[model samples]
Target chain A: MTVQDSLLAPDLPFPIFQISQTVRRYLLYDINTVTWLRRTHNILGVFIGSLPQSPQQNVFFGLPMELQPEEATLLVEKGLAFIADDFRTHKQAVRSPPRAMANYKATARKEALATAKAVTKQKQLKTQEVLQRLNVRQGTPDADNTVDNDEPDESIFDTSTQETSSRPVSSSVIPYSSTPTTSYPPIPTPSKQSSLPLPEVSASSYALFKHLHALGYFMSPGLRFGCQFSVYPGDPLRFHSHFLAMGHDWDEEIDILDLIGGGRLGTGVKKGWLIGGAVKNSDDNEKHVATSEDGQSEIGRKPGDFHVRTFCVEWSGM
Target chain B: MGDLQPSALTAYIEASRPVGVLPQDSHHHALAAQVLHNLQYQHDWTDLRIHTDSSHSARPLLKPLVSGLPPHRIYVHPDEQIEMLKQSVQEKDVPSEREWVLPTHLRETWSLRKFAELFDGIDPVPPAENQASEEKPPFPTAKGGIGSRRGGKRLMLATVGDDSTVVYYVVHDGIVKPRQN
Candidate 1:
């Protein structure tokens, strides 16, 4: 046979011309012998109703029991053909675009929100159960003053459940798993916590601290209380709450808000201004600490160095 | 989950360290201090401080100095926004800002009574504008920008997690008109 005919035919060593002329369609050595053998085996496999259980284990039943290595390749190739159609179909299915991906995402968001809600509900139920359990335990003589440090004070946390859960039910808002009541480190005692100024700091001082605290700024608790929050250096006020407040005024409230609504401070009643904070004064006797160029404690205060202080008031009526 | 993280702030959880010899088992204060440092560097906040409860029955406070920043409407009632908008047209100047958000964080569970205690300590408006004055003025006269008028607005609360993620929320002391979604 020519190379073209041999390429098209299964690799085998036999006489093709003589085989066609003969009855079994097989010659002592012919290129089409493997094809004929595979067709035979395929028939037997289908007949047995159990295709070779695995690709690796597949053995054409009619192949010579003991074939040379070269002949072994032919038998394996034949077995591969039996399953090629199924493999091709699977591949095409995998490559095709998913029909429901978008729908899946939408459903996922809904599911997440549902899960979050469920978690909240479950937590509430668990809390109620624990509370009841506590009440019963407390009634027992052994339960007196058994304040467990491991658990949150349910009285404080439990009372707010109605208010906290009452928040509008937004769909699919899963609370990040990392956030939990457990994650909060146990709070420290007041006197040992920080060297920071005491609550004894005037109402205005404490108020400023609370306002800044709420705004995500942190300061040195040990030192004289100072207004210091995290921000890019050189421009400390870049993300300061004051900056946000000003923007809110300019964007939403002020008409001629050239400087945060040219409205006068203290025009409104009950202000929550952030008065002076912790800092070092220049003079040993300097009652008020002066500010540096960056609004921090002066780098090196001379006897004459001054301090910076911020004050605010709530104003109403245009 | 839609996989969209709505939180604007990010955080890192430092491995818990041994609390050496601080009195009153105050290791959490040190952790909070570390968190405060991270917030200042990462979130661009100024004048951040941690205030623990004096009564020991309350949680520690993470306070930020946000006087002029623009963030979420810390406090809002959908109903209040409409009233403010209606009044906006007749106002002499621009309308007043609605919420006064504080850039703060919470790590412990809080009671409303404790919250009220905190609220009681705080003024409806922020402190007076002394920081707005000059650094070395011969006299303690008010300078720069002070007395700027605005409403008793909402406060943006940035609650930090140990894993370095900050979940933000809006909070108000008393009842205010509700806002639209």
Candidate 2:
């Protein structure tokens, strides 16, 4: 569902609105789609940080969708989209399992527990046999051995924790949560989504987004052309996208494959692949961060302190 | 339940790993599942179906492809647009309504031949609701020789980025006339 549909939901737990950024006159607060959609009134903003995938997908491919910065700013004025916390990042705090995720954990935990008990029992038997070979006497007799067999050593689970730390085990009360074979991070026992708010835009992308927004280009997600944003001269339906734009940090090195692949995709589709970055204003580098704290509105927008530079990549068929 | 979570499809996938129900190739299933989720929720798409194995040829699709009925018009058929133009309707856009979703991963590379195989296996429209269950998706109606949008080809390539963002672009087999803006 779009962010607008989510805000209509009445049962959302309290979501703390974190200040993410500010561009021009707009206040870019970070809210998940639910709040961003409903609270923000679908006014426009790129809903970033998580795509709707199943718990099964989370357990397997946990890739989350990021919001294009231009879309984020674009949505605020229109009240259609919202900058949601990256679901992938907050999933580290997966509190609620819903039905499916709970089921996976229930089954996986049971499987792990059963396996844990069986393996421990075998170790007990082997240890007992070793005593027999050495002619050792048991003070507690078979009764003690049977009792030990009845209770699986909980310590085995502690060792399992060392091997797989991603599991969000609420407590040791639930057994077999640390299943080594199970690739899923321990589903926090409850199925509730995280209530924490977050900042959606990265520094460099936000800078580029602000730069492009100032230049008056309609920007949307450009994953279609393997770029960060797709620049449009007008509303997307009215015109084909003009450029596949991407933003990077000043010192970051881009891979050659990205250059070739991006160039090819752009040329094939007849669009330019635009790359850009925020170059720190060397004259006043230290004061830039200090100046970003202008007000309660922007905690992001550090790009203002640096000059933004960009260029279009067109494939030259020599 | 999706209030604080991501999309409804996410809830659906997390619901269970029904034994023998989901397709193999964890990544393929992941890509298809993402597209299916986006269709069902993001764009109000319905009647979704998935195809992992191919019936037309010996080779299965590199990944599963999807087909569904879009809530809004996706593409404007050229002939239909011409008819609309003749009537002089201000809004020439009409939903193509039904189409196929070609699920792809960004990390993977695509050559012309690979795209040809995909086009060769697909149809002008999505599978019918009834027959959809009887067979896997990707029922090619008429032969669409691949080029650009050249031969009136239609396939929405749903490419999934590592970040879980699935951006869809209308990919035609060959270069077709530029639609009247």
Which candidate gets the maximum TM-score versus the true structure? Answer: 2
Q: Tens digit of lDDT per residue, candidate 1, span A200-246?
A: 22333343333343223432221111222211111232422231111
Error of 1 at A126 (Å): 68
- Chain B TM-score for the candidates in order: 0.44, 0.70
Task: Give the CAPRI rating of model 2.
Answer: incorrect
Clashes of each: 114, 43
lDDT of 2 by residue, B60-177 (tens): 6666878887755555544545655776643313323466777777766554334545655655555566864434333222333111112244567676677777666555543232
Per-residue lDDT of candidate 2, residues A1-318 (tens digit) = 676555554333322222233421122223343344333332233433333554333322221223333444435333343333334324544554476667766877787777666665565566446544433343345455544542243333355533333343334423545635333354332222532223456777877776666555667666667677887756555777767777877656554346446655776786756666675544523432343221223344445345555544444331
What do the candidate models score in CA lDDT, each in turn?
0.34, 0.52
lDDT of 2 at A161: 38
**DockQ per candidate:** 0.01, 0.01
lDDT of 1 by residue, B1-181 (tens): 6877544322222332323443223445434545445445654544444333322334433332233222222333334445547655322232222222333334444332233334434445443235552122232213321222223333444445557555434334432222233
